[model samples]
Target: MGQQGRSRTNGQGGPGAVDGFFEYARERQLIKLRRDAGESPPFTGDPVLRAYRFCNVFREDDRTTAWFRQNVRDVLRESPTEVTLATITFRWFNRIEVGEQILDILLEDGWNAKRIRSRLRNVQPLVTGAYMVKTPPGMSKLEGIIWCMKHINRRSLPQMPMTSLELAHQWLTQYPYLGDFMAYEVITDLRHTFQLQDATDIMTWANPGPGAARGCEWITGHKYNRHSKTDRVAMMNVMRELLRLANSDEAFLWPEDWPRWEMREVEHTLCEYDKYMRAVNGQSLKRRFDASHQGEERT
Candidate 1:
């Protein structure tokens, strides 16, 4: 793990408010689903949702993730390790086009940090705002990243034993540049692609980041700890409970055409729900959505 990984989870909501949280997730998902079907602007009449940007209900539906599948994952499907390496490389930058450039360097016949630096030298702000990568003092972020990539490619990560999601997360986080948060993110992508079979068998394994922890807390009306292994397991239980409620609820009918929700997707949406609730409560948000951003999909 590098620099940004562990953090204290803090928030509380009424146990009775689970219904409200469910409603928000349901409506937010509906808006995205409708917009995807070629609907006009103002996807929702709810002012907060309309004005603010939130991630899609399913992580796979995110635009960059779609690009990842086509441009990176499929390109290297023969080797699971290569797919994982490209996935990490793509996600490290989080920009579809720019990620491809970096990935080319990664897949080159020779490993060269200088080449990586040259391609990204003039590129101001190489990373997307979705995730931040921090390096040690005096060492440039580019150099740190190159070193990290070299280690990942050369290490035995592909050969590592992954008996469960928690163990996969643990082994992956042991590498540089992969924090608690990013390890789970990469592993989720890997599992969704069916790379980590043994790990995905455990249905209740969803690692919580700070945002997901807040979301789980919001739904359960209790404090959730992202650090504790026990709490990580419990967090998914809350997700399952909410999912069960959604299946039985009359107000929110999940579209049959849509893919079934997975623990990973639910965990991701929970973070977006946390952001949505934050906006509803009048808290400041980092991203804004307006008419200019319409028709453009983002991850």
Candidate 2:
């Protein structure tokens, strides 16, 4: 059956039908609210006032729900399709009503079916909870990207100015289980979104010793000693470039609309990093043991 027919038969129907149901439900709720207040519905065309009414009807006394409904529209407004897809993927999928609103707005704003399809690919993978309960095959790539982005945390690395290349190399070196693909994705995001440059500068800055003072201060908080003039100058140059890239208006931030997903991805990334570090330390111990045994045999 065609989508419209299938949707109708399955009770999913058209957007208009769904919208009508919500409108009716909202009207009934407002009627009850007005009756309780001993007055008719207050008339107001102000966008904020209308938003407040919608929040009151749909969210009731739930602070989180109200906050989401209030700010979600702003988050979606004028945001790129990729960003919007990411946001939706991060938010719990049970909130289909919100998703519909976003889709409707996008459609109204002249977004084509192809654009929607592209977005769906980027958004689908990041979905968790009930939304991801029984995902179908042939889902779009946008969905997968969203899925990964939602789950991947690029910030578990020490709050230092390590470039993406450095972070990936360190992660792979320390954790044998962290494959090239995973490291690449994490590192790329750190570079493009988090403004990390590359590995060499990161390693130089992170050098830990009594004489090590030249590095990104945001992470190391140590100024380059003047005595090491060359090192100090190089560190300063790298730091300046890092700051320039990160401080730009185009730099990415976890959107306020995606608090849940942002937290989940970050937490997961940190856990993985910690696990990798422990595994590396275990390998080091094994190597030491092997070396000692070989030395004894030689003696």
Candidate 3:
């Protein structure tokens, strides 16, 4: 037997071995799925892989600050460790909240529209530095991008193009979350609507959700998943902004190739999707939705 096989047989690998094996199996399955789907593999580079590893590490030991220090802080070149540490420690805001705070700060600092555009690059680092230590599993790199864009849109900062609601709808479709409502709202409030062609492109790029939709349908006279034409347009705009943000070079530290590679690989695994749907349908609606959405996106 190979070392891995022997280790598993001897029970010497323990949970770590089992976990690694499962991960390997999952990747293999993903590759097969991509091949079957006739698609290229998704990208997996420094930032994307590192972010995934960091999230895994965080999940394994939520209490440990070492993960942040080792994974994120150590990656910085010229920044002082103390400064990085302080930045991580002092941050009290969630990803979106922090973006809002930064927008306020920039405005307060007399950053003009041009300066805001230039300084937009600084938002990622600032938010990353702040939330690196206590990163949540539900908050993805894409979410961070959306949050940053929302901040810019919310502030109506100069030079920032007006994003529409239809775009937001598309982005939220890919990565649904409770916080996305605010983003949707902002897009709806803005003018200069996107063309339907642009909206579809944004939808394709934004990768919106297949999960249960949530928002102001509660007290406000609106219904979830029952968006009006105006609402749909607004959502599309928001989604477009999210796509733009996500596709930006600074969106992630990982080599841009990683997600594309993984996405491509995952697409071929229709059997896996079928299996997941059959096995976990009753127990996990979210999983089912995710699998279905991924499958659709792959095609």
Best by the lDDT measure: 1
Ranking by lDDT: 1, 2, 3
User: Better model by TM-score, 1 or 2?
Assistant: 1
Tell me model 1's lDDT, rounded to 2 decimals: 0.67
- Tell me the tens digit of each residue's lDDT in model 2 across 1-299: 12342233222223342222223223424433454566633422222222222212222223333333344433443433332333323243324443553455333432333554545544443332221322224644344333433343334334433443545445532433233333433343333222343345432322121111211221233444534757556544543443333233443322223222221122222222222222322322122222111111100
TM-score of each: 0.84, 0.19, 0.21
Give the alpha-carbon lDDT of every model. 0.67, 0.32, 0.30
List the candidates ranked by TM-score, beginning with the highest: 1, 3, 2
Q: What are the candidates' C-alpha RMSDs? A: 6.6, 27.5, 20.3
Q: What is the Cα-based lDDT of residue 202 in candidate 3?
A: 25
Candidate 3 per-residue C-alpha lDDT over 1-299 given as tens digits, one digit per residue, 9 for 90 to 100: 12353233222223443232223324433433454587754422112221221111111122222333233323331332222222222232223333343444322332233433454544454433312332235664444433433333222222223243344444423422324433332222121122121233323322122221121111122333424556554434433433343345774522355342221111112223222222222333222222212322110
Which stretches of model 1 miss by more than 4 angstroms?
1-16, 106-112, 153-155, 246-253, 291-299
lDDT of 3 at 184: 33
Point out where model 3 deviates above 4 Å: 1-224, 259-283, 286-299
TM-score: the better of candidates 2 and 3: 3
